[model samples]
Target: MAQLALDDYPDRYHLSNELHARPFPELTAPCRAAHLAIKQPRDAADRDRGRDFAHLVALLDRHGAPRPAPGANHYSGPLGRGFLKWEMHTEFVTYTIFADGVSQRPFSGEVFSLFPADWLAEAPGLVVTSCLVRVEVAGPDLEDRLGREVLSWFVPESLAVSQVVDAEAVVAADFRIDENGHCRVAVFARPGIGARRLGRIVQRMLEIETYKSMALLTLPTSRGVAQAVARLDGELSGVVAAMAEGGGQENKTLDQLLRMSAEIAQLSTASAFRFGAAGAYEAIVTQRIEVLREERIGGRQLLGEFMTRRFDPAMRTCRSARERLEELSSRAERAANLLRTRVDVENQAQNTEVLRQMSARAAMQLRLQETVEGLSVVAIGYYAVSLGTYLLGPVVEPVGIDKAHLSGLLVLPTLLGVWLMVRRVRARLDHGATH
Candidate 1:
């Protein structure tokens, strides 16, 4: 028997392996991590991505780390005292550097020094989010030391501390920028926990911070749009009020409405991508927090609670701004439609008046036509009677009848006959026209 032929899809393998593209690093406890997220300008969707690749190559070259494959979106390898993982996202790139051991001092601002100053200075984009995370072994008196030493690292009021991943690790962060312009996160993991578990914990914490900051980037845009929309609302209200007052200026009102609608459309178009991105990033932050399944540590507020109190209101504001924009757009469209309807109605009224005038003129013309027809009938009858009188004058005299008397008798009948004939002819023409 012949073997059956098979067809292969070109991207089958590549697509299937996409989920594993960025596997969580294997991290033992007692490690220091620094995460940096860099982004280009908002309007630079088509900016030169090669700059990111070039910068990554420079860093790799300095540390003699293995070069990433060409056209790769992510890479992970060793760099001197740490292993660096770099991932290029749609709007930004993140580099996570992790060293195997913590410094002698906790949260001393030394962990982030792993990045070469010269290399960072030459970065291609601006830093949007930077975090210093320190993972250490949990000591016997971890709870007691937290208030005295750990809690002091962050603002006491705003600090969020929790035990996550079934109490595999305790995480603490204040979500504040220090003097060095970096956020700090601390994780204390049980010594017996597997390295992969620790890695996952650290990854989740860093992601929460990065995504949170990214989500807030749209706040300013939302505020600006809100102010612009408010002005348009007032203008639109004035236009609608004018229309209600029955101003004979429908054309002007329509023009104003069209301009308002166009401006709203432009605003929506400009902010569509940013708004959508913000929503997506916010969702990711929530998902990351949920997966952590945090429990309170020593009656302290959990990270989720902190986000609810501090971060959720900002997201709500962004949402409200978007809703307001949509509402204004809808109102503008409705107003324009109303104005068009009013214009159409006014035109109809004018047309009705014109038709009434035309009807009056038609009635006058019919009356004049009737008078002209009567005169024509009379003239024709007179001519007919004269002709009859001349032809029958001799015959009438033989019968003892005067020609004048005969002509007078024939005039009445002639007039009646002519009138009837004219009426019949006109009637036939009218009937034909109707058909």
Candidate 2:
């Protein structure tokens, strides 16, 4: 029988297909784009997943936009005269709205007007980052255009402008919000630049912004928990100090330490995801900047350099907070162990005292039992002698013997016999007990 190569691994098809998912949108030059990332409250992970799907459907239905298949993670298609792309990620969803041409006034709020105001208000999540991108054909005046018009609108110190993709395009952004509370990116591409290349450039920019925003989400978390972490550390230090002092309410101290440990553990569990997600997102932000392989434009700082100076510090703060949490947790654990050891030693001492008392009582009971046993023998001998005297009287009277003398002689023998018998019974009892 012909055997097929071992049946493909159950997820082989799905796993391989994932790489092709969310392919970059094909775009033409002279396009104005609006990108938005929306995130629910921190508790969104537990919210109904259907809500996201429903929201996507509502937007698609509005413009007669083609519906994505059920359980689709991404979609790109026509929205009126332009195109729209939607992608769902682990923590949030992204929407990119593309138009055919650049707005006359750069970074105008008009691009966002494409999404009906009512529809936006009904979004399940609030906007985390919204950016207006101005894409135009490249010309010899690229540097002049930026120095004359764009540079004035952005902060001189923070602006990052770079030429990328073999210098076919120059991209610049200040990473700062404008008067309308939206960031702006200007992309000037040479005429012959392929649509796919332009699309890749745009995609990278959006990703940089999205992941950067997500990474920053952990910053507030870090700050909020900073004081609590410090307090716990101080308390833990006190506990350890008291432990070192070698006395004074070790149990109480242990209780306090354990309580603090519990709190720290709970905090760690609560923030674990945010910290981990931040680390991942930060890495992505760094990678996205690297892949751009940027070169300086007109002595402007490269994107990589800008992020190093400006964005890197924020990420470092997040790292520091996470490290502090870990250190505090470890300290709490060590303190708890020391306190438990103290409690165990104290308990052992108490048990030893209890045993000593038990031994003393047992000895006393043994002495009292011996005295009772001696009295029992004497009583038994006395009863035996009285009976013997009565029986011997008749025999003595017949022979004219002295009954009193016989009784006296019998008393010693009776006492000896009763004592011997009592000892034998006690010996047997002791032997049985030993067995």
Tell me how candidate 1 scores on lDDT: 0.90
Error of 1 at 323 (Å): 1.4
Residue pairs clashing, model 1: none
The whole-model lDDT of each prediction reads 0.90, 0.85
Question: Residue 238 of model 2: what lDDT?
Answer: 76
Off by over 4 Å in 1: 1-10, 44-46, 107-118, 370-435
- Clashing residue pairs, backbone N/CA/C < 3 A, model 2: none
Task: Kindly list the per-residue Cα lDDT of model 2 for residues 1-435, writing each as its tens digit.
Answer: 997778898999899999998788777889989998988986765666667778888988988988989988788888876788988888888889888887777777677876888988988898889988888998878778888877776788888899998888889888887778788888888889999999999989988988998888999999867878988888888778888988679878888987898899898999889999999999999988888888887888888988899888988988888899999898788888978887899899999999999999999999998898788878887788788878888888778667687778788899899889888998999999999
In model 2, the runs with Cα more than 4 Å from the true position are: 1-7, 396-404, 411-413, 427-435
Candidate 1 C-alpha lDDT tens digits along 231-320: 999999999899889878999889889989999999999888878988999999999999999998789999999999999999888888
Give each prediction's root-mean-square deviation over alpha carbons: 3.8, 2.4
